[model samples]
Target: MKKSLFSKVLFVCLIIPSVLTQAAEVNVYSYRQPFLVEPLFNVFTEKTGVKVNVVFAKKGMAERLAREGQHSPADILLTTDISRLVELHDKDLLQAVDSETLEKAVPEKFQSKDNTWYGLTMRVRNIYSSKRLGQVDLSYEDLADPKYKGRVCTRSGKHPYNVALVSSMIAAHGEEKTLTWLENLKKNLARKPQGSDRGQVQAIHQNLCDLSLGNSYYFGNMLNDEKQKVWADAVNINFPNQANRGAHVNISGVAMAKHAPNAKNALALMEFLVSEQAQQMYAETNMEYPVREGVAVSALVSSWGQFKADELSLETIAQHRKAAIKLLDKAQFDL
Candidate 1:
């Protein structure tokens, strides 16, 4: 009986360590689509043997995290757009990270001042003009030119992407000038601002409009789709503001949760994401430019030719978000 009891205790002791090891996991609350992030998590798990649990939602991640407070199981928050990152940081939902790997990989302009978040990839706001239009070079300022009146196509001005762009405009040119630009841009729209970025591309292909504003990646995505390839082929990507402030660029970024349950594993994942292998995968799989210096972009993205990106700090741009939204409303852009 004594021998049997000793064996049972030993068995329980061995199982405890196994269970503890298996519990080493990092949970992610993400605003990015699942397919875009799942593969990276799978790779991270393969290399580190730490499991990853993800909860993806189209929006409201910050609200959810705020509601969860200290009891939240989330270890990381991955999302696109500096505005969203700033929103969470402002709400104190994220914790500052001290990773040299992240600091070294991300540029000063693309990272938080407090090291609360790091940009993972970049996507430029480019002008897509119909091939027949003969407008090879364009500027964001020129989009409002009277000559182009009744020719521009765009999504809703209230869309996050456009708000960010307008925010950058407010950063470069102040609120009054940005407001004027918005009014003129609204006057120039081909129709009531409606549809996705790709829809603008489709409008351009159908000759419904002469030009549209869209992110660089959508061009690549459209080209990869059979039906959309024609729309993609119909327009030439013109990097706006190349001769002046440079094209406005936005980022997809990551931040550590304020009450991370697996902080160590989260840090490991953050470091791994900025590594060369992961940066390259980000470029290839998402068609976004890698935030890490020296990482090559996908061949397709590279073929689009290089142009200077706006040097404005994203934090500064984010600060103008409220003003941008107000200007959009004043301009009645969606009307």
Candidate 2:
């Protein structure tokens, strides 16, 4: 009887731990690449003892989340780009959580109006110019200069970054003036806007275009690649519109699924992410700026120097997105 009671107690101890482990697990579906977001997950699991199950897809996370609905097992949604985040909110797939931590870490412009989503990291649309040249002129309007005609390269205008940049112009000017700018800008492209932003930098090395518009991180990432390093090394990265409203910027952020299976765990993870440790990892690894104040920018990013970012509430950017996209379509900015 003594041995029997001892065995039963031991069994209970083992099974209880397993049950508790299962209870703490959070299932996440992320639009960000695995490498980009998994580190944050690992850190969260380490700190909270919550196990994470992740499903990574390059696109269609929104549709998948919608299809899953209340039956969905996803407790968290992590993605890049504002449009998709806005889409999920519009679809009613996100739930608002009252986290004072998130509010303190993220700015009002970088989060959803209802707190359904929150921005984690920020990036800028910047100009890359030749260092061999005299003084660098940093202005978005410089692309329209006749000297830059046939010397400008960029990624797809249909891309969200470009769309946001164009949207900023539309906000500053108006639809008619923004359309004319794009029309002339497209005519001046050295070659058609093709390939990724990195491709635009490569065009700079090849002398295909004297100036290119691309994400700030691409410049840092290229510093590690052999062939690409040549392109990145030869150029000077500049933040345009410094004396004016500054460069166009966007953010990569997160939200909790409306029917989070592990709502508590999801909130804990969000809190951990905005913490300084995770924000540092986010900035150093991704070459992005932490949304929180006083976290130093990455060395690579800082080297490019600081410039103003359009202070338009990011929500305004999202609000104008549909109109901006319509203008792009009308301007025939396909290339």
Candidate 3:
């Protein structure tokens, strides 16, 4: 019998998998910068004999996957911010991951209540003030004070970081109260909201403002980066709302794709990512807090000293997002 071209092609395709099986691989679509997340993938492959193929983009990974649907090639979604992950989950794009290692590695405060997403690191919204100004009672709410008028600086209120913080405020307070607070805060701005959180710190050092809001990691990076040392040396770090429940917090998190082609491997990767070693890398390298309980906070972070973190579930922050954005607009936060 003569062999058909189609039969030969199909036979080769079937055998190619056995040839490729010698090397296990995983594909990741990440909204995080490659330098920040690639190191972990390298670490994962080293320990598990799995090679990771990554595609990093600043935005649109979610939309790309949603467009691709079950045909999506992404095995995992790595991102920062609770809102993004929760949005993915709400859209039914993420599948629940019930790994014991993940549950043990991440605390309840950091991970999704439904186990749809797992937090790998934590960020705290913090305040930075001039040491020259001396002791200060800093609070996110205090940003609204009349005394700080023309002495306050911040990134644009529309930024996700600020939006999430505002969301938390709404949950803590209410729509009416949040609107009032944002209006007062707008009146105090040294300059219209502009620049990255780090830029706000730079403005303070330049004497452009007496205070600014930043993520705790920005302080750590500033303190360590040679380029930012002068700005870092000039300020004192203050954790907001210590007198109340605590400062609002956020996280860098991960989730399995709804149709993960490599579900078992992805679960393994998720578990490994929350391990002590990975958490330490997240804390030390990124200047983020470890999601796990016993891991020591990074030395750089610790030097800033300890303060309370808001105990509210992060999901509540996601839930209040719309209300916060509305309040932001109604209060003329941009003004």
Q: Estimate candidate 3's RMSD in Å.
A: 2.7
* Candidate 1 residue spans exceeding 4 A from truth: 1-23
lDDT tens per residue, model 2, 1-335: 99999999999999999768757898888887777778888988888789889998878888898898789989888878787788888889999989999998899989988889999999988898865664696788878777778888988888878888887888888888888888888878898778998988888888787888988888888996887899998788888888888778888889999999789888888898899998988888878889988888888778877778888877777877788888888877774
lDDT of 3 at 106: 79
Residue 323 lDDT in candidate 2? 80
**What Cα-based lDDT does every candidate model obtain?**
0.91, 0.85, 0.86
State TM-scores per candidate.
0.94, 0.91, 0.93
For 206-318, candidate 1 gives per-residue lDDT tens digits of: 98999999999999999999999999999999999888999999999999999998899999999998999999887788789999999999999999999999999898899
lDDT order of candidates, best first? Answer: 1, 3, 2
Q: Go through the candidates in order and give the clash count of each.
A: 0, 0, 0
Worst 10 residues of 1 by lDDT: 17-26
Q: Between prediction 1 and prediction 2, which has the larger TM-score?
A: 1
Which is the winner by lDDT between candidate 2 and candidate 3?
Answer: 3
Top-scoring candidate (lDDT): 1
Give residue 312's lDDT in candidate 3 (0 to 100). Answer: 90
